[model samples]
Structures are given as structure tokens and as C-alpha cells.
Target: MKRFLIFLYFISSALTALSSEKGIIDLADYHYNRKEYYYSITESMRYQYLYPRGELYSQSMLITGKSYYKGGDSGRALSVFSECYNRFTDSEAGERALFYSGLIRIDSESYNYAAKNFREYNYVYNNGIFLEESIINLSLVYALAENYDEAGKKIAGYREIFPEGKYIKQAEELSVLIKEAESRPEKSLLGAGLLSAVVPGSGYFYTENYMLGIFSFGTNAALIYGIYDGYKKKKQFQMIFFSVIEFSFYNYSLAGSIKSAHEYNENKDFKKELVLKFKSEF
Candidate 1:
């Protein structure tokens, strides 16, 4: 009986090992397709560890990195991508890992790092599935880094290279947007304030707050006129009362003019920056 039980235990152990080895990769793929990213990572890593020279070894590493990225662990995702690409150079999986890592870097706003990876990708592969995407991302990274001239050049060069490419319009639009951001009016907060001090309400006009400028000028003119008329009539008490109101209005106009100048410039610059923000891919 003891010998029979020992024989049965050996058979069961062999069957379990065979099944685990064969099904490991398939299990990882199943989890990845279903968006069970954590499960996918576990199984993919298991395959990589147990079968380092297996047919799907590179694929397992790619799967593991992709799972980490899609599962919202960017740090781990980058680590895995780096390891896999380094381990399996000059292969589809290596190129794919590099491309995905670039995307992850771009998402994190690491424009310079993303640019390096994309440039390396271009250098490594003459042409492949990610060629167009890498070029497009390079243009975007340049723009995000505020290298407007470089960004424009990239866009123009890409258009020449791929006139009928799928993402040509996006690159062109980015170039146009960069130009728009560069042409912001050079009006200054200090200059606007000083102008309004010299010529009441002219500051708002300079800042393009036409309505506020008009209202400021009209209100100040009325108040000053009232105080002057009170004084000319020799109504001392009335003049003093109106003078107090005029002083308050006068102080507010000066301070408000400076504040309005600041607000207008701040809002103008904010909108200009939004052009870049909207164009940048998340």
C-alpha cells in the first residue's frame, strides 16, 4: 500500500509541473486581455523566472511591463520596460518596450526623457509600426519643452517625409499653436499702471479692458467735477464732504487700475499657455 501511494504522489507531482509550465504564458495573456493587470503581472513574471530561454521569454517580459503600466504603476512599468528592452535588443518585443516606455515618460511630463527614447527608437529602427507615432511624439515633446523653433522644424520635416501620413494634421496644428503662443502682446503690468496714472483709465485701454477704461474715466471725471464745483461756490462744508468722496474714488482708481492691468495680463498669458496645454497629449 505504501509503495502504491508513493507512485501516485510522483505521478500527481509530474502532472502539476507539466501543466504549470505549459499554461503559465497562456494564463498571463488571458489576464492581460481581460484587464486583470495584477494577475497578468504575476503570471508573466512567473514565466520569465521559470523559463528564461523559453520561446515566449521576451513576450512574457513585455507582458509584465505592459501590465504594470496599464495597472497605474508607472515607476514599476518603466523599470520593467528598461529591463526587457535591454535584455532583448534588436527584437520586436524590445522595440515595443522602448516605445511604450516613451509613452509612459511623456505621460509623466518627462519630455526630455521621452524625446531621448523616441530618438533612440528612430535610430534603432529604419521603419516599423511605431515609426509614425515616434515622430509625432517627438514633435509634441519638443513643443512641450517650449522649444518652439525646434518643434516647428520637426513638424515641417515630418510633413516632407510623410506628406500623406496619418498624423500629419496633428503635427501641423501643433506648429500653428506654438506660433500663436509665441506672439503674445508684450504689454507690461508696470507700464499699464504708469500709463493709467498719467492718463486716467488709459491703462485698462492698453490692457484691452475697454469697457472698464471707459467706466473709470467717466466716474472719475464726474467725481472731480462735483468736488470742483463745490469749492468754486464757496460752500466750504459741501466742498469738504465731496472732497472726502473724491479722495476715496481717486485712491480706488489708482489701485484698481494697477490691479486691472495685472489681471488682464495674467489672463492673457494664461490663455496663451492653454494652447500648448490643449495640444499636448496626456
Candidate 2:
């Protein structure tokens, strides 16, 4: 009878412990669902403290990382995710942690690191739940880093690997965007500088800065006419002053044209478009 009673006591204790463990994670999840990220993190941390070896340990850690991420604490979130991935590399939670790490890196504009994380995830998890997403983001990271050729290759590989994938449409769209970006016209810096040197503001026109071009041309023409008039009228002071001003303006115009050419090539529009597409699709 005593042995039977002791066995019942132990079973009761085990059940209670199990319930407590499950309860804590459920509370964390509840807070997370309600967007109470602070409370979610608190509860998740509590779970980790109370049950270091619990079956739900990975889940609690993941929730903690996600809460940090949602709360705009990317550095902490990344640290947590990296730890989770390192500790539980074979678990579902680990896979998700690695995926989120990649996403955070992307947001931070650390494209190389983001690409590495996504590539590692793909390599480690052949059948990962986030496989399609990883592939797409890998391509996006490449594109963001301005490696459009590699980006195109990644998208092509994604299409080949997952023809009916969930992100197939996004892949197709991104592929189109990459092609367009590649084909977009680029202003030549040498051409712009040479044009400006030959004709005051022609370089600005070459880079499509019509207003600046007009303004520059007018200013230079006025200065040149002033110098000529001064010279013809024997006004030495006026001629020398106009000549100095024109020289200064001419150099300024040349420099400005070269800078504009660089800006045109940088082309923020394509990057902005790509970013919007990534955000919308993801």
C-alpha cells in the first residue's frame, strides 16, 4: 500500500510539472499573439529560467527572440536566434531561428551576412519549411548587394528547384525586375565630364538635369558676354572679374555634372522597387 501511494505521489508530481511547463509556454504564446511583446519576452524568459532542460526550451527561446525582433530590438533578437540555432540546430525551432536571423540581417542591410545565413539554412535543411523563403531571400540579398547576375542565377535556381513553389510568382517578378535593372541605361561619367568641359552644361543635359543644364548655360553665357563686353570697352577690372567668375563656374559645372552622372548610375529607384517587392511578397 505504501509503495502504491508513493507511485501515485510521483505520478502526480510529474503531471503537475508537465502542466506547469506547458502552461508557461502557452502564456508566452498568448502574450505574443496579443502583441504584448514585452510580456511575451518576460514569460519566455521565465520559462527558460524555470525549465532549462524542458522539451519546450527551444520553443520558448524562439518566442523570446521573436518578441525581441517585434519590439524593435534586433540586436538582442539576433543574439537569441543565433544561440537557439547553435544549440538546437536539428530542431524545427532552430530552423526558424536561422531563417529569422537571415531576415534581421537583411533589414540591417548586412546583405553578405544575410546571404550567408540563408545559404546555410538551405544547405542544412533540404526539406525545411522555410526553404522557398530562404531561396527567395538569398536572391534578394544578392540583388540588394547589386550582384544582379548572381541574383538572377539564384532566382533561376529557385524556379528550377521549386516550379510550383509558394513564392514562384515572386521569383518570376524579381527575375523580371533584375532583367530590367540590368538593361536600364547608364550615363557615362567620362561622357558627362567631357560634354560639360566642351559646353558649360551639356553634361547636366546628358544626365537629364535639364533645369540645371539651362541654368548653368545661362550663367556661363552671361559671364562670357560680360567678359567680352568688358574687353571690348577696355574695362580691365570688369574683364578680369568676369574671367575669374567664369573659370570658377566652369569648374563647378564640370564637377557637378560628374557627380550627377554618379547619382544616375546609383539608381535608388530600382533598389527601392526591389525592397518594396521583397516586403510585399514576404
lDDT of 1 by residue, 153-263 (tens): 878878988999887777777777778756855567788778777767788788788998898888778877887888889888877887888778666667777787777
What residue runs in model 2 are displaced by over 4 Å at the alpha carbon? Answer: 1-19, 193-202, 209-256, 279-282
Please give the lDDT score for candidate 2: 0.91
Cα lDDT of model 2 by residue, 1-282, tens digit: 999999999999976764598888998999999999999999899888988899999999999998998898999999999999999999999999999999998888888999999999999997999888888989998998889989999999999999998889999899888888889899999999999999999999999989999999999999999999999999999999999999999999999999989988988777777777774221
Q: Model 1, residue 121: displacement in angstroms?
A: 0.7
Best by lDDT: 2
Q: Supply the TM-score for candidate 1.
A: 0.63
Q: What is the C-alpha lDDT of each candidate?
A: 0.79, 0.91
In model 1, state the lDDT of residue 217: 81
Instruction: Give me the runs in candidate 1 sitting further than 4 Å from their true place.
Output: 1-22, 185-282
Which candidate wins on TM-score?
2
In lDDT terms, how accurate is model 1? 0.79
Q: What TM-scores do the predictions have?
A: 0.63, 0.73
Point out the worst 10-residue segment of candidate 2 by lDDT: 273-282
